[model samples]
Target: MMAATDALAGVLTQMTGPWPVSAAARELAAAGVPVFPCVPGGKRPLTEHGFHDATTDPGQVEAWWRTHPDANLAVPTGATSGMVVVDVDVHAPTDGYEAFERAYRAGLVSRWAFLVSTPSGGMHAYYPATPDRAQRSWQAARPGVDFRGDGGYILLPPSMVSTNGATVGYRVRQINTGPSATLDSDRLRDFLDPRPTPPPTTSDDVQRSADVSRLATWVAARGEGERNRGLFWAACRLAENGVPAPDALDVLTAAASQSGLGEREITTTVRSAYRTTQPQARPSSTVQGSPRAADGWFARDATVRTSAPGRRLS
Candidate 1:
């Protein structure tokens, strides 16, 4: 998901143009993404307020640059600019590119996208912001990656920051010249900020998973009055999830026996429950159902989509 640090800054090496911060600001404002100024040779905002002072006004932008000709260009993220950025420090194999790779294989980031080469040899992948609530800035999702979402901003192309007594600037590695539209970030959030995996739901771990264990215990504790009903319900739960009828029957029988259900009643209840839950009647075809029958059963596949297809990233 990241290029080498050498290649990171190389993203903008071919540039041959005037370092006109004001002109760049005008272009961004014309694109409808608001802009602001950060003190040149530094990232401190020139405006009294920080990102909140971002403006689309050409006059303000001209005046600000006129006052401080060397100020860097910063764009507020979130709704105003309609974008979020994934900040990747190009320290692969050191900081956490391996961790980032794991997330990437898990489908965390889009391979082809626009990015801005950062001043500190980092690359910022830009994604259109989703329409929902603003996402707050996140620090170090992995060792090398950070996120600038809602309530945050990024110093943009043609913006210079000082390093090693010299000036380095951000440049558009991938340029978006079309109408800005949202990029689906549900996958990014889920992958970067994943929930811990719960224990598996294998028969061995049936007791390990709280939901299955609770249901099993509920069946095993039923008394005479509730014995058949409990066994049927529990068996039904297993069968509907395509547990083999025999496996389901075996579990229900053991639990019902402990609950004082006679053998005949246990067999009849389990068989009837299985029949209703598994319409195929054959146990061989019982491998198709919900949570109880999944690989990483609690795993949810998040939807990923571009706001619009064919939007070029230059």
Candidate 2:
């Protein structure tokens, strides 16, 4: 099994060049491997496709193909043809695993999806076909979800996977059965369609920003020790307002700097808080009239003021 795995890894290294081959190969080598090589049509090449070499044993390559006959050499087509790949790092106890699972399940239901789980517990979700479609799908599924489509997050490929030595690339395996290369129009429609009117925003949503500010103030009052706590709440607040991660990171950084907390500490606290609670939800009113709350915490908080009608913090 190890030899076979190593052989598969080597083949991927030669073909893809060094983005992250081992991780991709691990997906192929998993117990119920979801990996598929896309052949343009349903036809297998007569030769080895020149992917083999002295270091890569021919028998291993043939064996991999034999087991994964659905793997294709053709360029991916249809709606998913231009799909962008987003890499998600699942930092174990963080929101990474849950986020990937939720996104994957959502995609399965939407038919506007493709996802791969890395050996490191991270995930890469791909939207089929068009870049615009992918971006739209991602935007419609932001905050709780992370998308790598255009100008979004960075996708770090496995170390040995590359298009050349410099550019990173992913392996494209064509599906021979189960589904056609054509895009699912319904799925595409959903991808292109605007999100349904959000349930009328509640007071909770509006007060959420204030609640975060209050939390920040509370942390600040506890001396510089709680600075990270303040930044965490701040990031959550900004993220709820549709801010991107980088922007949220910046907000957290600024908040931390002002409060005398380390960036790493702030980042860790925010990520930890994100894992534990839904940041968009309003904070408890118990903290409302506290010392932190008295310091103009709620006054300057935007998230609190924007909560949908009838959902104010109690």
Among these predictions, the greatest TM-score belongs to 1
Q: Estimated TM-score per prediction?
A: 0.53, 0.29
Q: Which candidate is the best by lDDT?
A: 1
Taking every candidate in turn, the Cα RMSD to the unseen true structure, in Å, is 22.3, 20.4
- Clash totals, every prediction: 1, 42
Question: How well is each residue in 1-314 modelled by candidate 2, as lDDT tens digits?
Answer: 12222333233334334333333434433422222232322222223321111112334444555765434331112222243443444321233334434433444322223333332333444434442342322321222233332222212123212122343233322111122122333443344333455677789877865665565455444444444555666666666666455434433443343343433355556555554455453322111111112222111121211122123211
lDDT of 1 by residue, 228-266 (tens): 788888888887666656545535544454454433356
The TM-score that candidate 1 achieves is 0.53
Clashing pairs in 1: 175-314
